[model samples]
Structures are given as structure tokens and as C-alpha cells.
Target: MEPFQWKQAAKGPSLFYLSSWMEGEALTAGFTGRDGGFSKAPWQSLNMGLHVNDDSKTVVRNRIAVTEALGWPFESWTCAEQVHGARVHIVSASERGRGRDVREDAILDADALITNEPGTLLASLYADCVPLYFYDPVHRAVGLAHAGWKGTVAQIARHTVEAMTAQYGSHPSELLAAIGPSIEDCCYEVDGPVISKVEPLLKELREGGASMAPNALIADANGRARINLKEINRQIMIKAGILPTCIELSQMCTGCRTDLFFSHRMEQGKTGRMASWIGMGRGEPFS
Candidate 1:
């Protein structure tokens, strides 16, 4: 069965939840869909990102709706100003609610956010870029990372794991991870420029005992290849010592499911973004 279960709230935003993880623990982990918000036209309804040319007030409203639907307060939402870099920010209690309403206050120049602080939700915006989630049940820490091809090549996945380990003393082997919805290989084709950069990273992962699916990065005679970024990141996690059995992969493709997800590639770069979030209160071991 697919890990992310789709649910439409009666008066709330459409969501794809990592329900098994939420049910077994105090954590709430999921990705937002492209419906049930108040944004108009290209971003019509359920747009959770403020940087996508959506009105600030409407974006805040949509964010509030998501918080309410999760039974969490809006003040608990913390965001990152992603620059496609590998910088992983460690969020604490003092950092709660940054960028909940505006972009200026966001944790700047970071693509990954990790926190062991309870009640502080970690969120990042995504259109076609992959969302990488991390949870260290050993240290009660949760993390979220945004990975476009740039961030992926920068090794954002491995950096997130290292950050959690360094800050929370989290052992990568004990981490539970999830690769959220994004553009899969079927709809993600890249030319030589991108391929040149990604090849080195894939080569390193391969040398480190990390394997990739055949469709993960397929090349054509024309110098372009269909890349499964999600799988590539998964291999990165493995290279970083995260157990393969502990990782969950979402099968929903943003490009094919544009009706449910906002796909930047499919929409010609004129689309809103979905948000991936994960947080939990202080708690005991995973149930």
C-alpha cells in the first residue's frame, strides 16, 4: 500500500498524510495538496507557500487552515527560506513561528530544518522539488529538507542526517525517514548540464555501497536523461548510514498528479507550492 493516504477535510485543505507514522507516535508528518485554500487562478485554493506570488494574507489564511486541520496552533509553524543550498538550520524554542506570516522573518538561506523542540512545526515549500523528512525516535528530533536538483547535488539529505546526529546525538541507523511527493523520473528529464553535476554524487554513493534503481537516472542518446530524484536521495540517505528498511517512499508523482499537486515543470514554472511539515510534542519512545 502507498504510505501517504489522501484525505479531504470537510472545511479544511486537502492533504496527503503519512498516517502510519502519525498513528504510532506523537508526530504529525504529511504533505499538503493543491486544493481547499483561498488563492486564485494558477494558485487557486490551498497554496501554502508565500513566495509564489500569492497574496500574503491569503497564504497566511491557507497556512492557518492547515495548522487547524492538524490540531496544531499557527504559532507552531516555522519555515525556511530555501536557496537550494545544503545548509541545515537547527531550530529551537526561540525560533518558533518564524515566517509563519511573512518571508522576511524566515530562517534564511537554509534548505533543511531540524528540531527536537516540542510544539514547533518544521515546514518548507515545494512545487516539484522533493521534501525529505527525518525523525530520530532516540532523541525525539524531527527534521525537514527541500531538495531540488541543486539541493540534491549539494547532498541535503546526508547533511540533514549529520545535523540531527551532531545536535541531538542522533544515530543515523535509528532514524526513520520519508521521501515526500515530488516529480518522479517519468516526468523529470534533464539535459547534460544537470547530468554532469549529478553524476559525481551518484558515483560517490555507488562507491559507498548505495544502489540506484534503473529508472533513477536514465540517459538517452540525445544527452538528456529521466532522473528519479527521490530514489537518488534515498541512496544518499543510505550512504549516510540510514537503514534502508526504515525509509518510506511516497509514490505520488507531482507532474502526473497536477490536479492534486502543484507541478512547476508541468505548469511551466507558473504554479504555487505545496508544504511538507512534521512536528511532535515531547514524548516517549515510538509506540
Candidate 2:
């Protein structure tokens, strides 16, 4: 079964809940779909990013809807100013609500956010980029990362795992990770310039004993390689010491499934963004 289960409502925002890791009341982790809110076209409904040209108030409304669905307080929402870099930020209680409604308040220049702080809902925006999730049940830590090709090559996944290890004493082998929806090899073909950057990374993964899929990077007559970013990222996690059995990979290709995701590649450059969120809650609410 797909760990990220589609929990669609008749007339509300469509969400992909990370069900496998939600067995306890202490954590909430999942990705959002492109529906059920109130933004106009281009960003038409459920746009969680405030940086896009969408109306800031409307984007805030979309975000509030997701928090309502997750039953988390809007005051706990936290975010990072993603720059496709490998920088990581640890969110404490003081940083809980930063960037929940505005762009300038986001954690500066961080592509990954991890927190052992309870009630801080960590969020990162996505369109076709992969959403990497991490959870440490023993230390009660959780993380969210946005891995575009640049971030993937920069090893944002490894950085997130290491951040949790250093900040909360969480071990990579014991951490649970999940790679959410993104463009797959079927729809993501890169020319030589992009392939050149990725080739050396793949070389390192092979040298490190990563079990890459045979089709992880397929070559064609045009001298371009169709890259399997999800698998590549998975192997990167393996290289970072995360156990293979503890990782979950989603098969929903954003480029192929436009009905469910906003594909930046398939849609050219105009589209809304989705939110990938994770947080460790304090306890059961009195409400």
C-alpha cells in the first residue's frame, strides 16, 4: 500500500497523508495536493506558498485550511526560505510560527528544517521537487526537506539526517524517512549540462554501495539521461546511513499525475505550490 494515502473530501483540499508514520499521536507528516482552497487560476486553489505571485492573504487562507485539516494550531506553523541549497535549520519553540503567513519571516537560506520542539509544525513548499521526511521516535524529532535537483545533488537528505543526529542525538539507522511525490524518470529528461552535474553524484553513490535501480539513469540517442530522482535520493539516504527498510518511496509522479499534483516541468513555469509538513506534537489537546 502507498504509505502516503490520498484522503480526499467531496468539497475540500485534497491531501496525501503520510499514514505509515502516523501510528502515534506525537507526530504529523504529509504532503498536500493542489485542490480544496481558494486561490485563483495559475495558483487555482490550495496554493500553500506565499512567495509566488498569488495574493498573500489568499495563500494564507489555503495554509489555514491545511492546518485545520491536520488539527494543528495555526500558531505553530513554521517554514524555511528554501533556496535549493543544502543548508539545514533546527526549529525551536521560539521559531515555531515564523513564515506561517509571510515570506520575509522564514528561516533564512535553509532548504531543510528539523525540530525536537513539540508543537512546531515545520513546512516546506513544493511543485515537482521531491519532499523528504524524517522521524525519530526515540528522540521525538521530525524533519521536512525540499529537494529540487540542485538540493538533491547537494545532499539535502543527508544534511537533514545529520542535523537530527547532531541536534537531538537521533541515529540515522533508527530514523524513519519517506520521499514524497515528484517528477519521475518517465517525465524528467535532462540535457548534458544537468546530467554533467548529476553524473559525479551517481558515481559516488555507486562507489558507496548504493543499490541503484537499473533504470535510475537511462540514456537515449540525444545524449541526455532520464534521471530517477526519487531512487537517486533514496540511495543518497542509504549512503547517509539510513536503513533501507525504514524508508518509504512514493510512486505518484507529479509530472505524470497533474490531476493530483502541480507539475512545474509539465506545466512550464506557471503553477501553484504544495506544502510538505511534519511536526512532533506535545500531547493530546484538551479541545
Sliding window of 10 residues with minimal summed lDDT for model 2: 278-287
Error of 2 at 99 (Å): 0.5
Clashes by residue pair, model 1: 37-46
lDDT of 1: 0.91
Give the alpha carbon lDDT tens digit for every residue of 181-261 in model 1: 999999999999999999998898888777678887999999999999999999999888999999999999999999899
Per lDDT, the best of the predicted structures is 1
Estimated TM-score for each candidate: 0.97, 0.97
Q: What lDDT does the true structure give each of the candidates?
A: 0.91, 0.89
Candidate 2's residue-wise lDDT over 1-287, tens digit each? 78888887777788898887877466778899998989999988888988879999999998998888888888888998889999999888888899998899989999999888888999999998999999998889899888988999999999989888889999999999999999999999999998888989999999988778987899899899899889989999999999999999998999999898888889897889999998876444311
**What lDDT score goes with residue 110 in model 2?**
93
